[model samples]
Target chain A: MAIIDLNNVSKSYVSGFLMRKKKAVSNISFKVGNGEILGIIGANGAGKSTIIKMIQGFIRPDKGDILIDNNKPFDPASRIKMGYLPENPYFYTNLTAVELLRFSTSASGMPKQLADKRIKTLLETVDLYPHRKQRLKTYSKGMTQRAGICFALVHDPQVVVLDEPMSGLDPLGRKMVLDLILDLKAQGKTILFCSHILNDVERVCDRVAVMDKGHLRKVFTREDLGNQTMEEVFLHTIEERSEC
Target chain B: MLNKVLSLSILTFLEGVRDRAIFGIGLFALAMMSVTLVVLGFFMRELDKVAVDINLSAISLAGLLVTFFLSINLMAKDIDKRTIYCVMSKPFSRAQYVWGKYIGILFIISTAFAVLTFCSSLTIVIAKMQYTNWFKAFSWIEYFKAVYASFLMFVVLNAFIIFFSSITSSSFLTLLFSICTYIAGQTIEEVVIYLKSANGQEAQLSEFIQKMIDILQYILPNLSVFDLKVQASHAIHLPLDYLLAITGYAAIYSGILMIAASLMFSRRELP
Candidate 1:
């Protein structure tokens, strides 16, 4: 069974006094199977994050259905096995990195001893252990991103969703995050990530989902790569969808 | 659910404490309290009244600053910064978020009041020592009661802030709405009393004006009910039933506001 599923989900946002309606995601549908690493690739404003939001139950779909663990996204139980890291995530600046991790782990119902142990390990893994005592406000952008990653994974969720996880990271940080994603994949965890970096997606994703102008243009597997790279396929699909 | 709410509440409280505005307001309140020393000297026979009035007003003004600056900023920051996306993605409902934030702001306000009231009480004590004979009628119990009521009033005001934060997209608009609520809430009872007296005297209240006052009395909080400062300052005996009734009023009104905030926030979409 798919751990994350969206069947014809659509969302529109109204703006301004005139209530001008803008379609954000249109009839978007996909499924992330257990232990599958799926990457969503899109340009800016291509509705990648919107799909993640729906899967995480942050927003309701205007039409169609969304299911996590075979339950509606609106159900808290449906999110029991899910973890999410938003783009450029900001945490409570007053909290140390460890404190934020503790909060996250506790929210997931981890007992004190177990949560503390996991927090120690995760901070070490992300190379933030040395600075975990410092408030999040004092951390650099890359450090904050790493903390956000730790926050998402602290609960040891079976399905992880990350939006633009590599956007603000340096070369080394990007490499570290990519290795972490690969590590999670090896652990048999299902991962769904949104990114603009085609190479990183190709490296870690079992399948790639392309979005263009709020529409799912194509879903490509490793076998479908053939001689064409993800960038080429991505551009072609977007151009084809635009022409249509 | 309780765990989530508690965690969020703790985080919110910590964040509020770290904010420079709280420190700034704390200092501002202390400075205002010190001014009572100078202001008290200006009055001869009513030194106790001046001290009580200044001290209570300082606490009230401090509460306003925390509500308008710290509490509003906390709620609005989460949304405007999109940090709420991280929070909302957890196993929490919108109502949980609202309750957690409201409780956290209450904690900040309560702590601020505790400290300020302590300082204010000390000020009153120092003044009492200087004029031992004149402060014969002063009651510490009454003064504390006034502070408690003032705290309850701010609790209701913070609820209004939460409701506004849930509905409005911009913090500025939330601030504006909350301030307007505060202004209207503070004066609506007085307006109602005036209109009623005018009606009794046949002094002519327009039907529209009378209707507006009636609507405002119900819509806006009757904050004046919480003003026990005059009674405290004068050492008047306050009925126990009145204090209990106002406490109940604060709880029910805040509860309703929270429910409304949760409902509105749940329906809201994040950008």
Candidate 2:
């Protein structure tokens, strides 16, 4: 069964100061099935983050429907079962990693005992146990991103959405994040991610969605994507869309 | 759902604690309050003259510094630091996020008021020594009224900033609007005084301005109403009916501003 669905959804934003109208995502639609890792690739301003924001309900779209496991995705209640890691995640810099995780748990309403256990295990899972008590302001970019992932998974939600999760990292840090995604997949979790790093997405995603000009350009599994690179596939699809 | 709001409030409180800049701000505010003692000790003959003015003025000034300047800048710091997006993405509603932030910032303002009031009253004690019996403390009741009044003033000010911060993309506009609110709130009495006087040219203009001002006087939160410094300094007795009515007015005004702020926040989009 599909775990995530966007049917005929559209979003437009009116610029606050300029009063200019912008159609961020126009009639966009796709799905991610249970236990599937779907990767989305697009350039900046391609409505990648806008779609994520809509799915997270930070901003409601103007029209159509979005369902997470057949439930309203934009409702606050549906968020309890979903975990999202934003690109360039922000933290209370003065807080220790442990404290941030604890704060997230309290806000998410996870039981205190379970919250503690999860924090402990997740810190170790991310290899952040050594810096758990250090202030986040002192952490490097990679370390902060790791802490971001830890907070996202603190509730052990059924669906995990990560936007550019591996962007700010060295090779080893990227490897660690890629391994984390695989680990989550191994445990039967449904993962949705968007990336500019095509190689990273190619290695982990079971299926891939390419978005361009506020629409889904194509959906392909690893085999259909094949040894042909993401750029070549993206080029072919954009050319097809333009011609049609 | 409400539990999330409560928990976020606590987190907001803790986040304020973590800022550490507020501690330095508190100390500076308290220092000014204590400086009044030095000035009062220098002019021991006019002790009561200085004590009443200094103590009451210190509360408003300290509260103005914190609530006017600090509260307006608080959200700016979170935005500059990009920490706002994380909080917004949680299961928390925008109303909860904004109210939590407002309440947390208010906690800091209240603390600043308390410390400043304490230091100011201590000056009152030392200054009142020469005026009254040997080394006897004058009275805390008057100072208590000042503190309570200042607390209300800060709440309105905090709400004012939070409301503007929601709709304004520019911190400069937000700060300017807060200052305008402050000036408008302070001049309401003078505006009313000019309203009733019978004159020809100026009065016609004044009355038109006065009518508009009268509408603003009730519509905006009145900083002057919460200001009991007149009685505190002049040792004049304030009417109980007027004071209570003003407090009730503040409560209603603050509620409307906060509800409007919540509505604006609900429609905000985060990057």
Candidate 3:
């Protein structure tokens, strides 16, 4: 069954003094079935982040529908079992990692004993246990990204949405995140992963969706790639669409 | 729902208290209170009255600074810095977020007021001890009433801040609107009084102008109601009914503002 669904979703935004409307996403739709890792890849302004934002209910769609576990995106109850990490994740800088995670757990209604245990484990998993007491303002970009990961997963949410999760990570950090994504998939969690790096997306995602100029150009499973690498397939697909 | 709001509120409070600006404001208020002692010596005749006025003014000034400087930043920073994304990703409605943040700001204001009240009370006590004759008319009950009213005024002012923040994304704009509202709210009562008096009638204001003023009086808060400094300094006890009336006014005004803020905020597109 599909745990995350977007059916004929469309969104537009108005900007500047003239109030010109720019179509962000037009009638785009897809679904990530239970325990599926679906990667979304596109250039900037291709509506990749817009789709993620719509799914998270941060912004509304001008038309169509979105559901998380069959509940409307705008409803708070829909996000109860969801976790999200945004591009260049910005958290409250004055709070320490432990304090932030505790807030996440507490907001999700996690009990004290279980929350403490999960916080410790997640911090340790991300190799941030030693600096857990330091304020986020003092953390480096990579450290902040790791902390964001801990924050999203602290409540043991069943559906996870990640946008540009690998942007600030070092090679070792990237491997850790990749491992974490794979580990989450093993745990039967539905994941919507959006990233610019084709290689990372190809490695973890069961299927990859390619977006171009605010349209879902193609969505293909790993088996559909045949002998072609993701880089070759992606270039061919984008160039082919541009040529037409 | 309450639990989620409480969690967000606590987060906002912690963020507010840890700000370096808050510490600076606290120090400034304490220093002002300390200076009151030395300043009191100059007003030999009305020492108690001057002391009460200065102490209360210090509290009022501190609150204004926090509302404009610290509290506005706390509320606006979430939207300005895109931190709202992380917060809204959880099981929280936008309305819950607004209420939680407003309550958190209240916590910061309450803590600052509590500390300043303690320091101000101590200063008043020392002044009274040194010049018992001058403090003959001073009443502790009236002094506390003035402080309570001032705190209530801040509660209303913070609601205005939240309402402004919901409409605009810029913190600077929020501060500007709040300042204008504060100035207007403070003086609206006096303006209405003058307009209704014999002097105002001599001006022969047009019907349109008079109607506009009337509408504004009902719209903008009658902040003068919260000013009990003169009465407190003179030890003139206010009636219990009057106190209850203002309390009810603050409650209703703040409640309406929060509801409006939540509605505006919920409709906003988090770009």
Better of 1 and 3 by TM-score: 3
Give the alpha carbon lDDT tens digit for every residue of B80-199 in model 1.
Answer: 778787777778888998999999999899899989999988888888888887788888889888999999999999999999999987899889998998887888787778767864
Using Cα atoms, each model's DockQ against the true complex is 0.71, 0.58, 0.88
Evaluate model 1: give its TM-score: 0.96
**Which candidate's DockQ is highest?**
3
> Model 3 chain A: which ten-residue window has the lowest total lDDT?
A71-80
lDDT score of residue A115 within candidate 1 = 90
Give candidate 2's error at residue A97 in angstroms. 2.3
Off by over 4 Å in 1: B199-219
Ranked by TM-score, the better of candidates 2 and 3 is: 3
Report the C-alpha lDDT of model 2 over A120-183, residue by residue, as the tens digit. 9999988999999898989999999999999889988889999999978888889988999999
Grade the docking of candidate 1.
medium
DockQ of 1: 0.71
The most accurate candidate by lDDT is 3
lDDT of 3 at B261: 99
CAPRI-style grade of the A/B interface in model 3: high
How far residue B7's Cα lies from its native spot in candidate 3, in Å, is 1.0
Residue A8's C-alpha lDDT in candidate 1?
94
On residues B1-271, what C-alpha lDDT tens digit does candidate 3 reach at each position?
8998999999999999999988898899989988988998787498888999999999999999999989998888778989988899999999999999999999999999999999999999998898999999899999999999999999999999999999999999999998988898899898787876674455577889888988778667978889999999999989999899889989999999999999999998888
Give the per-residue lDDT digits (tens) of candidate 3, residues A1-244. 9998999999989989999999999889898999999999988999999999998888899999998999998899888899999998999999999999999999899999999999999999999999999999999999999999998899999999999999899999999999999999999999999998999999999999999888899999999999999998888989999999
Q: Which residue pairs in model 1 clash with each other?
A: none
